[model samples]
Target: MKNEQIVLAQRPEGLPGDETFRYEDTEIKKPDNDEVLIESVYISVDPYMRGRMNDTKSYSKPFEIDEPLNGHVVGKIVESNHENFSEGDVVTGGLPWKKFNTVSSDAVNKVPSTEVPLHLYLSTLGMPGHTAYGGLLEIGKPEEGETVVVSAASGAVGSVVGQIAKIKGAKVVGIAGGDEKVNYLTETLGFDEGIDYKKDNFSEKLAEAVPDGIDVYFENVGGPISDEVFNHLNTFARVPVCGAISSYNSKEDNGPRVQQKLIKSQALMQGFLVAQFQDNAKNASEQLAKWVQEGKIKSEVTIAEGFDQLPEAFRNLFTGDNFGKQVVKVSNSLD
Candidate 1:
């Protein structure tokens, strides 16, 4: 069998394009001892991966030029040389963007069996969901009845953050780009208010949305939207900087200078990686799954069909084309 893999042709100068990726077909490798051959089913595409594409010192290692781009993959074991796993077992973990991956058993884990849909394991019950729960509860520390404003509110992390805040008795205001996303937040997710940041008078509209000022600001996208949010900060607001997708593509740091606002409000601001709260992963997944089952929380995955669509779908992340968690469906033979 031949494995088709997508490799980074070159480091992106700005927003990644077709020129940045290349597809290669190579012979599939047989698993050795302590290894398994995974038939990839689904792969996650995230905004954070954009940082990894850059040749810079960051949280994750930069993608090597001419090598296959790697990410979170949900696959099924086709062959296992390890004692722990067997053929036909569904699992998920860090895997290469290839049809077949021969990886060590330690690099993957069996998917948590649940009545909850399997694809969600790569979305809401996965990194993005945990990122929201950990960043908001731990850093933002939202209190009851206080206003929580989330930038990029329709995104994977921000959407979960908004819903969780509502569950905790806080009024949630979500900032998204369009009216479609704005409606999704208020109508579907139960957010108290939705702000369309692309509006002609966005700053004015945002100011009107959060009359009491922002008590908890889940900072997902950082730019003019956040600059406006900063102006409405309460005396001691909590800001959880989960991501800055707004500036990930730029070599220049165009991030808004919120130092004056931070000083004036004396608000707490912290940047966090989901792995920092590893101890809470299991619990967080369970809670999110429970909420999902009860219909208290709704999850959406904007799937791009076929492995070939991966590059185009990946580009869609920066374009704000996807509504929620974005994943590429590589195969449909789950049975």
Candidate 2:
């Protein structure tokens, strides 16, 4: 089989342009022992993936120039020599950006498709959902009737965070870029209030939304929005820095540079990866799946059809053009 892959053409200096990525074609090798040959179905495009576009090293290694950029993907196994997998099994994992992948069995998880749709494995039932769960419960530590705010509240992780906060009995407020997303947050996701960060009176509006002050701040996008939220934090508030997406492409990352607020409010600020709380991540996914099944939590997905749209789908995440979880639908049928 011939595989088409999206590669990192060069390290991005700031916001990635069209020149940042290039496409290449290669022949798909057959699965070796303990390996599986899978055809891509759903390709996840995320904000954190932008951080990997730079040459700098952080918790996750940078994507190499001229190499395939990999992220979470749901695929159907066509061939397998592994003990745990078989032909025609659906699975999800961190896979290379390609039409077909021959991968080690240990890297992929067999997805049981009795309940949710296959694409949910790339969104609400996947990594982004897990990130929201672990980050909010473990680091943010929200309590009943407390005010909780989530940035980028219309995006995948942020949307889940706000909904979960509401589930926990906290008064949830969402900070989004536009009025459409603000409406989605308030009407669809059931957030108590939604603030449009694009407005000139954003800080004042956020202040009005959270009159009691913020007890838990689920930090997704970090920039002017974060700086404004910091000013309204209550004493002993918790801040979970899940993703600094706003600063991902920039070389200098001064995350929420409001030192005085931190010092005065005695707020607890911690940055965490979902892997830090493995059990929580597992519980989060399971709970999110159940909540989605129960109609208690809404799962939103924005897919750019076909593998050919991968590059543009990814760049749209940085530009805030995608409303919910961004993924590419590689196949018309998962079967």
Give the winner by lDDT. 1
Q: Which stretches of candidate 2 lie above 4 Å from their native place?
A: 252-256
Q: Which ten residues in a row have the lowest lDDT in candidate 1?
A: 111-120
Candidate 1 per-residue lDDT over residues 86-115, each given as its tens digit: 898889898889999999999999987846
Query: Cα-based RMSD of the predictions, in order?
Result: 1.1, 1.4
Whole-model alpha-carbon lDDT for candidate 1: 0.89
Error of 1 at 191 (Å): 0.5
Candidate 1 structure, TM-score to reference? 0.98
Candidate 2 residue-wise lDDT at 296: 78
TM-score of each: 0.98, 0.96
Per-residue C-alpha lDDT of model 2 across residues 125-168, encoded as one tens digit per residue: 88888888888988898999999999989998999999989999
